[model samples]
Target: MDSVREQLQIFVRRFGLLNATCCEACCGEDVSLVQSHILFEIRRMGEPSMQQVAEELGIDVTTFSRQVKAMEGDGLVTRRPSERDRRVSLLGLTDEGRRVLVRIDRYMAEKIGQIFSVMTPFEREVTTRSLALFNEALAKVGEAASDGKNIACCN
Candidate 1:
């Protein structure tokens, strides 16, 4: 258990998720990991509601609102009121945001490519599957706990 925890910590840090800023060539701005994620999701979902992106990212609305405000200041995203629901704010990337997302995508792809280049095809497949399984399991656990179910481990 300790080994698993330690290895996961190392893996998280190795991904630079804790980095204060990304490479200039990538976003050419002080984009944090979370901010990059917001941009990526907006591009992927194509003008989703702010709440939708926040929920998908598992970020609280208040926290997500702040991040959106910052991104807006950076001119990477724009928010508009939904036509169907005046109260709901929809999020979309600006032209600059799209460019930034492209750079970020390329940068991440190159990094993953390098990592996979070292491993055999089978190894890569297993690694990918294991990570997906781990994520799914954790999500289930999180949902159960939040729903106030038997948190036996917590007890």
Candidate 2:
């Protein structure tokens, strides 16, 4: 198998290209890539704590906390005490964040549709079915749940 760095680099490169054509147009800034990723996932998952995002993305709590703070400064995302757990801060997309999320999601869906248009009927069917397996496997295995507190990485 190839190295993990190789896999990550490929994923990041493709992500940059995807955002350049879709997210960048709506956000008007290339640096918004990571912010969009965080905002999109949080919206989809409902209001997760900053710790949950850091856990899911394999980032340090301090790092994601700073990033969320910057987004708050920009008025794109919001933080509030969780009703169920007052000690934890629930991070959610503000109205501005929602607007950009919808736009970027639609753009990427269109981009994927365009890409799949080139595939043969059988290849398309196979690829489409395989995607279900991918999600199924991860849903059964990979989780990014919040613990309301920081956990040591690789512990």
Candidate 3:
């Protein structure tokens, strides 16, 4: 059997997480994979603050701000001062940005459907459950590490 690291590396590459130019069929001609994710998160979260989206994506505030500025220039995103907190900047997508996001979503859903079509129902069920478990396990590990405890779990 392949080592877990080897399998995960292959999975990540296949999922295009490491691709610089990941989305092109979705108006990603000018956007990098990271930028695409930022746009996606902004749209998904419905006008979150600049800091909120940056933290969700695990990007540094400075770098995220730069990317947001670039996207704003491209007319894909807009930032306005928060009414509740004047010091905060709330982010939103333009009409074109929403269209691009929809294209990206449709493309991704089609790809997932193609892959799921080949899997047996049982296999699909197990795979979905396993991925959810994996995410939960990773979140626990992350929380432990953030709290300055490095407890190892082997299962």
Model 2 RMSD vs true structure:
5.4
- lDDT comparison, 1 vs 3, better candidate: 1
lDDT of 3: 0.83
- Quote each prediction's TM-score: 0.87, 0.70, 0.87
Task: Output the better candidate (1/2) by lDDT.
Answer: 1
lDDT, model 2: 0.73
Over 1-155, each residue of candidate 2 has an lDDT whose tens digit, in order, gives 46855964686576564454445664454336667778877987798988788777666888788889998887779999988889999998888877777777877788778878999989989978987986676555544535422233332
Worst 10-residue lDDT window for candidate 2 reads 146-155
Give the best candidate by lDDT.
Answer: 1
Between prediction 2 and prediction 3, which has the larger lDDT?
3
Question: Which tens-of-lDDT digit does each residue in 1-155 have in candidate 3?
Answer: 36987998798888877777778634446678888898899978999999999877777799999999998998889999999999999999999778777878888898888889999999999999999998788778767775423333421
Once fitted onto the true fold, the runs of candidate 3 whose alpha carbons sit more than 4 angstroms away are 25-28, 147-155
- Model 3 — TM-score against the truth? 0.87
Worst 10 residues of 1 by lDDT: 146-155
Q: lDDT per model, in order?
A: 0.85, 0.73, 0.83
